[model samples]
Target: MPKMNIKKYTKNYFMPPKIDMSWAFKEYPDKAPVWCSVDLRDGNQALVIPMSLDEKIEFYKMLLKIGFKEIEVGFPAASETEYEFLRTLVERDLIPDDVTVQVLTQAREHIIKRTFEALDGVKNAIVHVYNSTSVAQREQVFKKSKDDIKKIAVNGAIMLKELTEKAGQKYRFEYSPESFTGTEIDYACEVCNDVLDIWQPTAERKAIINLPSTVQMSMAHVYATQIAYVSQHLKYRDNVVLSLHPHNDRGTGVADSEMGILAGADRIEGTLFGNGERTGNADIVTIAMNMAALGIDPQLDFSNMPEIINLYESVTRMHVYDRQPYSGSLVFAAFSGSHQDAIAKGMKWRAEKKPAHWTVPYLLIDPKDIGREYDGDVIRINSQSGKGGVGYIMEQKYGLDMPKKMREDFSYRIKDVSDHKHKELLPDEIYKIFHDVYVNVEKPLALIDFKLDKTADGMRNGTVHLYSGGKEKVLPAHGNGRLDAVSNALQKELGINYSNLIYSEHAMEIGSTSRAMAYIGITGKDGKTAWGAGMDTDIITASVKALISAVNRLQQ
Candidate 1:
């Protein structure tokens, strides 16, 4: 074997010019850039089965609801279905006045004419046109000169201007020098500025000059520099909305988009969950949420994120990665013991003080901010269980606040079960473990009946019927409290001696129920402790049941 000459195959990509790199040092975007979704076009094209007209409309409505003002619906001239979808929107008057439906086309006269025709009767539209001008695209694919490519873009702009005037539609214009990252910056600038010059954009009719990292070439910083240079040098700068269309070939699409925004791009073109050709586009969800985390309004609402993810998955037939930034099923979940403990304590602190910031450990925002509950979604239970998380689950889900030591004790039992079962436990299942093992246990010391009466001296008199030692015994005793009197009666009559009783109680605030829970712990003469839980409407009755549960476990 020839050792394959391992390093011979790869070559360095073309890097952009080394201009001033000041734009790369900004902290973060103070506001969201204008968001344009190409989900219906680029995203749909990538799907194995493109969305039907009905599904596309449903997804469009979702995007509208998410606050996207610009949507590239499809390449209307490419297919009848695409043309029909555009026609349906225009005829149905579904496009809102504030929203602009954009359509993509190559820099060809016939296709640009068909694109405008399909957009007939539309009140607001952005007719987007592009042609590849990268070195590889020009030399390998088109075999055309720079002058030839520039003429294609200039001609497309002229046709758009002529037809839009003829139709009197007042449509917006967007031009992309596709594969802009691979083209020489000076030449790319010349093409974009020429398009702008022909369009003669004004304040009333601003045009968009989109610089796509059609394929990411260099690192994020180099891309930012290129975007910064274009933003600085482009003619008709104020009337030009510099937009970015980044692809994830290098898995840095989001990073490129973020850097580009900082480098003076005014708008972002992406799809929900980054659904596009190749490795997919920059995920608009991530960009928006990242802005939100920094206290900047992302301008897009993802409050009902679960429903959004569900709808996107259903329509796109693409599964969102479980760790996808904000919309994933398990993005906020904590499974490690240390992680769970910090999150549990952080949540506790959040509740106690209602802090002005979201400082919950390992959590960027409240799960409730996205319609997720903290019970199962946040502090999950598994074999790696810790006291803080298990106890948090108990307190949040079922309202059973066990003592600290007892919580520590109970965590081990839950972990043992989870380790054996080889799976994570849901809230109800974890509660079931606590109920089955510790709550209201009655075996050898089953309480058949019990009554308590308060006397004038503030002492409690109690009567109990029990099944102990395989026989039923009746006993009577007195003490300072009802539960104490019951415990005394057991010790005196049944010779069961235990002391150091600990108790706590709380009402279950979840679901439709008036039930209360009581937790009791007792240490016997052997210094062995047993913990028990009971649920009932009456606190006293719940406590009595809990005491018996502890006693039964102690005897065993």
Candidate 2:
């Protein structure tokens, strides 16, 4: 070979174009889907900070208010707390007339007996029993053969049939072949058939064969195929309410559940925000909301979804990820300039027409349906962001239009800051930075004097004076933060005491000069909690505005 210096040309990397989502316009039937919230059992068990009995009761009340017919309260056989919670519901007659409380148990005599003990006086209940039947689970976990597992499942079903009959209880029987997703189709069918034979479900009484994707280890389409196959081959197909429970190990729980529904599953088993063991179960909120958007009645009153999300987060101590499907903070939020423009236009379109049909350009579902206010400032400009986002924020915040030149200048500045700080710019914080860079405001509430001192005896003295409305108010008080000092000073000047006040702050931007937004929760003498919010370049000013807003709310 000749010694020739040859250079190879490199191919340029090109990003694929985005696909249009107009296919969602196809009409689908409006059948109401059944929803089962495993929050008490699955969600609480998965939480690092589990809900107390009182919190569980509060959540149960909320679920009832939301019109849930069936709620899996808890595994009563698991612990004394769970047992007592179930007992309290029964003793107090808290279970509503229409609603049914569901309890889970393994296919064991003692466990089922304990579950029955917990449900002694319940008006309506369902006992969900399950056992490992798959080859992997049977051979590995149970160390049992296929015939052995089937015999156990049949015996368990017969026992439940007799138990419910003897007690004269209005109970429904449900069985799950644990790890059915990986089980041999024929074996699973045989096990389920044997159980159905023992139970002998009538036309009115259908047994729910809950097939759970206990671990999401495969693609969504594969799970759907498995569900379709099982649904087609189940022995008593018409007498069975096919159910699905998918976990989110591979982050496709929602997709798996939805496809499973399409593949013939009638009931869903999941937790709010996908809380469960391992990577958590599928999120019922997301699945229900998605179905609602698809023109199917998901049978959930998510009108106060924000409150529900907040309560779940508070009680469970599990935050919903920003990118999580419908319930996420950023699901309806947009950051691209084009996306913001489209969403803004979509809101305007929705103002003129009913949103029954999915005709909005950018929004997949109406934000109003889920208690989210229309966001005009969905886009912003930064190093990685575009002019759409920045322009939206500018126009929405100050009613200022960004001229072509100003847009470019502000875009470059945002990009520079973003690159330097390595974080996205918040709309409010970006507004403040823009105000400092381009607009100037005279100090409205300038601090004149402030002092905090402690005596040798450990008594603390705090005083603050501020210039406001052309008057100087010097008031002495005692409290925590400088913002609290200022609030107390104002309270003293106004002759008001805001004793039940809680304040929280969030940095709106990154780095040293970032602005902060404050949220204040105030409890009135009338026993009402009012929320107020404020944003400012100075954290102290933000807190002051929030406090003032809280006071204003009290007046209202």
Candidate 3:
């Protein structure tokens, strides 16, 4: 490996010197800002192969369904496909009355004219124009002076105003000082104010002054401070909609967006799942869902998260990572013993208390709110699982509330199986293990029949028939209850010595015809415990069978 020099790099971003830091005093946004999805343009262009026309339309329709009022359809002048997609939306009347479409263009005459030509019959549209304003772009890329770059932006804004007036259209205008993060904060604000002065926007017909962190180079707080400087110093401050378009070079796009909103930005332009240049754009799904988790209505519908993920992956050919926040497959899954235990207890508390708000531990919000189930999405079982998680599965799915000791014993057995198999145990597989190992063992001694009779003293007496080694024997005994009488008979006749028999029973379902299940645990002479279970329609018979099953387990 070659040694690297640390002296070669320098920070290119500049911070505002005289701005108030009041935006930092606020915690978070209490309401959602205006959301603008650039999925069709920004996200598509970065794909290995950009989306087909049909796929683009499908994606556009899904964006509308997700409650986005503003969608940047495409950069129509960039390609024939882009031009056709915009024309198709306008010609087929696919654009909704309440929605406004946005198109991107460079700060030049020919491209701007072609962009307007693509929006011939659109009722509501935003003509987005941009020019690079960062110091590196001026010195290295464009080789133009600061005044020259400012002239490009002012000319673009003048043409957007004149074109709207010439066509008798009430179209909106948006100006972006692209690469604003690497530019001087004061210079960026100056260019945006110049554009605003040309348009002379009113509150009813506002103009958007977008400051894009086109190549995020600093911490999130620096971006917020820059936004505050522009927001406080822009012309027509009340009428200008200050927008942010943050990319994720520093992996702080979402943080920049949230803090920027607190810094007085009014709108956000990004793509679904943050698909764009370099690392990606700001993930609108994450930003909106974060607001939802904070108990604020993001005004976006992401309830069916699975459906949204499916459509996004299908059209964009991008895989949503397994650990993606709130949208990934494993986001709600709990595999560790402690996490599963806490989640199981939290769910039980919710069922018992029915709280007005969601406060489950290890879970920020209910998975059901986003079309995921508790059983399928949460409380996953494996070798690392504990008693609470296994017990929760049994009680929630099978209605068998075993005692604490029995549950601990069962969990060990389950973990042993899972550890040896080196795999996760599904719910049905766990139930099968319980049924095969403990339920209804009719081995060396089998219970063929039993007859119960009440004595004059109110004591219960029973004759339990037992079969072993190809022989059958009927024994009579008396005790305070049927199960006790059966246990006494078995000990006396079969010489199966055990004591401290623990027993419990319940109906599997809530119906008169429901079958009953019973469990029994016995301590052998070696002081170890064995557990068993049985089921029948009659409660007393179920108890006798349970006793027999326990004795059989002890003999084994």
- TM-score order, best first, reads 3, 1, 2
Summarize candidate 3's per-residue lDDT along 245-267 as a digit string, tens digits: 99999999999999999999999
For model 2, the superposed segments whose C-alpha errors exceed 4 Å read 1-30, 345-361, 380-387, 397-556
Q: Considering only N, C-alpha and C atoms within 3 Å, which residue pairs clash in candidate 2? A: 337-388, 379-389, 380-389, 380-390, 381-390, 383-415
Root-mean-square deviation per candidate: 2.3, 17.8, 1.9
How well does each candidate superpose onto the true structure, as a TM-score? 0.94, 0.69, 0.96
Candidate 2 residues 469-518, lDDT tens each? 56786778565656666676667676655666776766664343466666
Higher-lDDT candidate among 1 and 2?
1
List residue ranges in candidate 1 displaced over 4 A: 1-13, 452-462, 497-499, 507-515, 524-527
Give the TM-score (vs. native) of candidate 2. Answer: 0.69
- Per-residue error for 344 in candidate 3, Å, reads 1.6
lDDT of each: 0.88, 0.73, 0.90
Candidate 1 similarity to native, TM-score: 0.94
Candidate 2 vs candidate 3: which has greater lDDT?
3
lDDT of 1 by residue, 439-458 (tens): 77878777777788999999
